[model samples]
Target: MKILHASAEYFPYIKMGGLADMLASLTKEQSKTEEVYVALPLIGKLGKSPHWTGKEFPALLPQDDKIDSLVVSVLKASRFLEAEESGLKLYFFQSDLFQTLDSIYGHKEEHFRFAMFSYACYALSQILKVDVFHAHDWHTALSLALQKDSALPIPTVFTIHNLAYQGDHPFWMTGFLKEEPFRLITSPFDHDGKCNYMKAGILSANQITTVSPGYREETLSEPNGFGLSYCLRQRTLDYSGILNGIDTEEWNPKIDKRIFQTYSFLDWKEGKLKNKRELFQEMGRPSLPLDAPLVGLIGRLTYQKGFPTFLQTFTERRHLPHRYVVLGSGDPEMEDAFFQLSETLPEVFYFYKGYNESLAHKIEAASDFFLMPSLFEPCGLNQMYSHTYGSIPIVSRVGGLRDTVEESNLLKFKTGIVFEPNDTSSLGYALERAKDLFQSQEREIVVKNIMNLDWSWKKRKLEYDLVYTKAIELKI
Candidate 1:
């Protein structure tokens, strides 16, 4: 079987978050039995990769000979330096429109950048030999909608990595669809004078799936739905949720070169102390007590991850003994909060602005507990990565965080701590629990349990295979 996986950013080349890592890992696993090709927008320099074969072709986006179209470069090759990378081909879309963008996101002309990339995906799909098409997030959601509107017989699967980012734009921008008679082609994209790319994918794709089973159900529920709950609810029969897996090679504590030292669960106690001591020295806090629990929080400092709660809790409960080491940069307000806290109390707080790949690895390896109080997570990889490194996660009971991490409340052999609500108190309570547990013998057992669980791509690949088969069956 031939399958095409289209995403905006893939790992090793460029990655903003979990989407790139998840897609890169899945495509590699899927390549074993099927003919898989990954298509991405080449926003970098044209000559950055000599590994790719120049497959630049002149093709009209909609396959219409009368319309004026742009000639784009399509680099076909395998991803560089991936050990398990099978015979999968990487299709990079190189065009002036996409290359000139300030970044992958947050540009003045964000809509047009993705619109052109989506059109380029349509052109590439028509040229490639694909039996099934899989599009990730709102970035490639338009690709599924375009193929569906053209009455393309090929089955398409649209995966929602996050429902929050819908690629919304002014409805007037969709004037190109004025003459289109198909409501399925136009109505889904129309959201009260707005173009909702994700809604279009939900309404048009053969099947829709989210990153986690719990998130799939939440998307059908209230606030978590992010305004497209009704559209997702309508397509209940075709939608599903599969928990995403982490790239074990990147997160493995035994072999990760980024960490201060490599160690497994057997030696986790000593391993953690050594790394924690190293971390304290590196952060310029050599005198900080190693006995006090270190709670590491990483990822974008946004409201989505309950960023405000952490700051508020730290402010109100300044007497709490545990140390907070935060490694991430997002939202100007949140950044200020972290910086202010560190300045006010250098011993209790340590903040680092911007992403440091090596520091992230070290934090997971060293910290006593990993804090990720996300308001709504599709499926977080950090929690999974923390579990692998023997760093218990203190996550809110929502979406994949609820699905993957079992709490001490109901289960006996639980993995991590879980709080019910998204407020400051709830997050504070969970952290308190994590701090107390560190003094108990049960903490060792929980870390062991978390590491024992399998989060490999091989296991998740089978579930995707089932979904792909179901999509093909629906097409028939």
Candidate 2:
């Protein structure tokens, strides 16, 4: 099968979130199975090497006249070696009109920027002669709408990374469409009295998918769907979930060059102690005993990540004898709080204010336990990575955290721990349990369990292949 994968961001070139990592990993894995092609926006500043090679394709976009005759260019990606080796083609659209100096979204002409991307994707499909067009997130959702409206020959599949970030512009922005045609194109099922690009894709596509089975169920419910629950419920038969997988080659601690020492499940304890001591010295903390329970957190400092809940638990329970290290940057208030905690409780807390990919690997490898107290996560990769590194994850019982971690593994297999979301007391209880397990010499069992769990992209790629086949079989 010849597949054209369309996303707003791809790894190495442009990446602000997990979607880029997902695309890079999934595409690389899928390349082994089928003829895969990828197309994404050429945003931000990029080196001149991966320059455009294809001829411009004409496209009609909403609102702006300058964007009406947009020129779409195909710039091939060189980051994924497997993609290139398997004869998979990658393309990127470059147009000064679509490229904004500001953020990826939240621009004044946000609708037009993404609309150009959607149309460019369709144009690329025509030029490449793709059998199927796979669209990711709301940014490329409208491509499915365009294909359906034009009655494009190829089938399309849309994957929703996060339903919370639906691109909902004012209805007035869609003035380019005539009244009857607009109503038909932006059907009531597609719009929520406003222009919802994700909704349109969900309504138009042959299949709809989220990152996890737990997240799939959450999107069909009241609180998690963010007002798109009814629409998702109506199309329940067409919706499914495939849990996200990490590129084991990139994330594995056994061969990671970023760490002080490489280690596998067999010698994890000895190497982990070395990493833990190094982490302490680097963070300017006293090198505690090798058996000390070191907890690590690496994610955005936002409400969704349960930063507020973490603060409440740590502050309220002062007698806890665990060391914590955090590496992330977001929400100034949360950053400030972590800094203050690090100062006040210098012995127990260490905070790093920016993102460092190598440092993250070290933290994951060294830490006895990993923390992910997210209020609602959409198939978190960190938890899975932690498992591979033999760092037991103590996560909230929500979203992908729930799907990935099991209490049986925590007890018998000795993999990880779990707590209730949005509850500081529950987080404290789970932490206490982790500390107890650490003191009881059960940490070795936990590491053994975690090392056995596999989250390779090859396994996940097979699941995606099944979805693609089912998508083609279904008539839209």
Q: Per-residue lDDT tens digits of candidate 2, residues 1-476?
A: 88999897776566667887788788878887788888776555642235334434433222322332222221121112112322566675656644554335446777767766676676667666777889999888877876776644468888999888888888788654333212235645345578888888888888888899999998898789999998899889888889999888888887899998899989998899889888777777755655678899998888888989998998887787888899998899999999998898787888999877789998998998899999898899899999999888999998888999987643556457889999999999999998888877677877887887989887778787877787788848
State the number of backbone clashes in model 2. Answer: 1
| Candidate 2: residue pairs that collide | 414-446
lDDT score of residue 132 within candidate 1: 84
Q: Candidate 1: how many backbone clashes?
A: 0
Q: How much is 382 displaced in model 2, in angstroms?
A: 0.7
- lDDT tens per residue, model 1, 1-476: 88988888787665777898899888877777888887777665332353645455432443354443221222122111111234678776666656665357666766656665665566566677578889888888877777786656568899999898998888776544333222235664787568888888888788889999999999997798888899999889989899999878888998999988899889988889999999999999999998988999999887888878767777777677889899998899899989998898898999999987789999999898998878888899999998999988888888999998887565778888888656888777877787789889998898888877788888788888888888888963
Candidate 1: regions farther than 4 A off: 45-50, 57-62, 69-87, 177-184
Predictions in order: lDDT? 0.78, 0.77
Candidate 1: residue pairs that collide:
none
